[model samples]
Target: MTRDITIVGAGWAGLAAAVKATQLGLKVHLFDAANAPGGRAKSVAHQGQLFDNGQHALIGAYSETLGLIQTMDLQPQALFERQAMKWQYPRGECYALPQDAYPLKALRSLLFSKRFSVREKSTLLKPLFFSVSQALWGKTDDTVAHLFQGVSPKIMRDIISPLCLSALNTPVSVASANIFMRVLKDAFANPPQSCEFLFPRLPLSDIFPLPCLNWLRERGARIQLNHRIDDLQDLDPHVPAILAVPPWQASLLTHDKYPQWSMLAKHIKHRAIASIYVKGLRAESDSKQAPSSSYPGSLMCLNDHDESEDCVHPQFGLQRDVNASTRNSHPEGAEHWALIVSAADPNARQTIIENALKAACEQLKLSDVQLELCTVEKRATFSCDAHLQRPPCWIDSGLMAAGDYVQGPYPGTLEGAVRSGFQAVTQLVDASFVSSHAGNTSRVL
Candidate 1:
């Protein structure tokens, strides 16, 4: 029980905690019900080819995630396709700041950028610069919808809505303004080059999970895949545990053992992320590698994002490897696309999938396409509403929770999940949760 930690659930969060605990020279036992890692963001194999269950991307601001990959000795650049964060539509309206550009030069690029009109550009910068005032005066502590008071419809249609949906997974009307502002500040003003997007070069699994399992095994950390933990009491009471499962599942495990904590975890609401996989994409319609570099076609915002309806889902379904090489992995090769619907209701899966696919086809000019699969991450992310209060990490003395749902500045993103897991283990070590079993606890950094 001494210096030994049990990590339940091997999603990004659980895996992160286990990694940190092992790095601090502790015994790590990681378990997940799923046969493979990557939790909700894992790659699913069907008909012999791999497809991501949910779409995932990274920003340079995700230092913890990037560091975790590096800790495994895997090159981040090798796993992902990096580009400056830009919101480009099929019809050509877009907005982005170059990765190498920063400060005044960046502002100039944005100011004169043809993405939006002169007035619309002001609408865009208002909230960004407004972050300065918010920091100086304290948090606005309101809904993101409030930020659009003077914004024109074009700006809302071409800009704000998509960013809000892609970032928060919640509509602008309810997404936390404080959190949204924090994301904007971190991506832009807080540091340099963080605005770049990191799209996985292959299936999401190959990006981190499988490699992490290998790294953990090599270090003598025990991993139990397809091993489910239904009851908390079944765990060695003396051994510390990190529950990184979804809030609902955690609620079930801790219902009687920790009623109050269970309530907190149970009360958290969730929104679904439905990933619609489409095949038979023609190269002319495939934007992943457009003839022109200016296309920025890897990820594009689709139409039908009704601002009044409060949805800003990104319509990304382009193939990552649109070459002959991928044909061996997937029958369609260059034609696989994973279109996503953020904040979709899982109960209405069929309706949502049908409408989303229709919108994507018409908007992206996709033709002769066939629906390969539809993955609905039932609890993709907790609803990031303005009124939300995320649960704390420490649930009890030797027990704690780790997930993006826990209290964090960022939204329910992979970075937030990674940071939470890493910090949970750090807290365990600092609090001497593993000290009685071992003497040298200074290894934790």
Candidate 2:
């Protein structure tokens, strides 16, 4: 009889595991409390328009996520619009990487960037050299602030700090330096395209989650939605199970079975992400106001530390034409703008949205913006602080766990979640194969 594998949680990690396990010819059973999948990365429809729980950015370096997308038979070109790395701030400062070659384009972009002073540009080399060397040897396991001890304050404010907040969802003062360095290594050390940004043309759910769910269902996998598994022991012990829920949920489910892992999961703090959607902004009719032909999309990084206090409102901003896609069925003449606030406060969500919209309008030279929708994910991602003790995938011989919070080189990201899923599934498959082989060998003896 084929070995049956039960998976708890229908998020990216769990879905990825289910797909891989199914491919391996295992009977797969997946469960989640939510009616639909995607977990924190999911999308919702409000007033006939679709929006993600939080605005997420993807880079070419996200190999695992990209691979999973391909494996699901989704064309990357159709799902995302790829562009070279471009960081446009509200203060008329832009830093765009060239599309030519690896180190050459990277160096050229840094040197030509108007955001950095000549002295600061020259100083940037030291950190780059150090990071490259450390990538080969090893990075210091400390706060990201300490990692760039002698770097210019300008570089830190403009580059490192934003990158840290966006990637790790933790402030640079406390984020893990090791993970930050690894991210940098992956971005610059690889091919130039690896540094390119991938903006989803569709809602994030359409990009991965819903498609993955359909793929699994069509393959004869049993999925139980809105079915919360309160106890792991309730399930049949003969079938191995993978718990791919959030860190907090995982803690609750594993407390009785694996107290140590539960403690670790409970200890893991979480960071919040708030996306404030605004509408009624004027589209750029003037050629001067429009982005270059190379960058047709509206993507901007908010100048969160300008002389004006209001400028430091949103961490990042994205503007999408509502009529661009027929999938969301957005009303005509309506535009959607999302301001991503990292480490957001739940109580002050309305105030945050208002401030963010004001800042965004001021920067984009638009007036009369209207607040359309505001969404906040309080436990969007686990805090990736220095020395953060994340729970491992293998909780016990018969049970495993998978999520972005699972101990990995990456922080809380789609890639991290998918990679963790693959890792957990591999562990389960390997153990099962080993056991079966051992049993056969013993019988032969």
Candidate 3:
């Protein structure tokens, strides 16, 4: 098929590129090896219920992602259950405020909350102060551990370690300061409400993937599912193309042509995420209590620290059954625990899940919790470590790269993926304009 542009990999990035190209009046053809779209953000069907492969939260600061969803005509408020930004621990140290509150409001909450002592709070805020200051005058590129050695248990348990683990998907000792600062800067740049957690009301696929694919197909963009492109010659070479797959797949596809780019992408280390779903079954005697209000919040920061290296509890805990209190998904009057462990060891999934289920039940005060299912995306995100060099989006004149792993300030997030996809389409158009102008100049000469 003759298309103005072809998008490889129909995950968020590829779907995003196809959407933008269609908006720009380009003939777009999109393909993916998977049966469905969404890549790492896809949903899984188990026992007739849809659960996300992993917990993919949409922060208020995700302007590009939010805008893209709006363009698809999906109501943000309808699709997502919005809650104020809150940093909470299992033992209940909370830095929180209403939606769109200034970033300073979080600090205010911290100062007012009795969970951490003055010295302990100071310890937590000190590194943040340095990161903000570094964002201004100087360049600070180091690991989290180096930036704050002798990291006290109080401060670590309070917020820093868990936040870094969730944000970077890398251990604080090895995570990159550059990427960390970029996340902070992006957060501070957006509207105060941008930091609110936009937890999707529906399954992950219903959120963006299916809606987007429907939109594209409703238009004229060709959508090919379970189709793989083996070579560059297999695609429409006359048109520009965007390789929007994950770094591993991107590396494999480009190894024959762009060797250096391929190598850089191939060498990018990845972190894994485990989605451990447990059913919170209250005994029939406790059925009188409100099942919907059983959990304190939709999500909370978990203290996954155990002296034993074998016991790595989940870093985050969310209540999947209570997606929207108004909707009340748990008609059976049972709670479903959605626990997430970022930077998980693929081999030790069973250990992590076992520890996390027990710990989370105690922390959240669940009556009876039984393991439902546990799924892990081994290559969930890139290991955003110090001195990491990501590949560029613009690969060549006719080919471009589009994914979260590309050169960007943000970490591997949906926002990063969407931004890269939009940028890839822009690059394609810009390159064509430049080439046409060059030909015209030569003709005149």
State how far residue 240 of model 3 sits from its true place (Å): 0.9
Q: What lDDT score goes with residue 128 in model 2?
A: 69
**Quick one: ranking by lDDT, best first?**
2, 1, 3
Q: Which 10 consecutive positions of candidate 1 have the poorest summed lDDT?
A: 288-297
Give one digit per residue, the lDDT tens place, for model 3 in 1-445. 2236889988888888888888877777899999999988878777656778887788888888989999999988888877766755555445666454355665676677787788776765567777768868777589877666655676665466776777788877788877876775666565466657777777888889999999999998888899988788798667678999898888888899899989988999988888888777656664443222333336766664632121257877777644442243554756777788888886788787787778656665566677777887888889888888899997776789999999987788898899999888877776562122222221110
Candidate 1 local lDDT, 1-445, one digit each (tens): 3778989999999999988888778889999999999898788877766777776778888888999989988998877778776655666645656555347434665676787678777766666666668889896488887766567777676566677878888878788989987887778764455777787776778778999999999999999999999999779888888999989988899899799989998999888778777765555546563323442226767755563332334344444552321335545433456677777767777776677667556665566667777888777898888968778898888888999998889899999999999878877877777753344665432
lDDT of 2 by residue, 22-132 (tens): 776677899999999998888888777787777777889999899898988999988888877888876666888876654767678888887778988787776667767
Superior candidate under TM-score, 1 versus 2: 2
lDDT of 1: 0.76
> Model 3: what TM-score?
0.89
Q: Estimate each model's TM-score.
A: 0.89, 0.91, 0.89
Global lDDT of each candidate: 0.76, 0.78, 0.75
* Pairs with backbone N, CA or C atoms under 3 Å apart (clashes), candidate 2: 304-312
The top-ranked prediction according to lDDT is 2
> Clash totals for all models, in order?
0, 1, 4
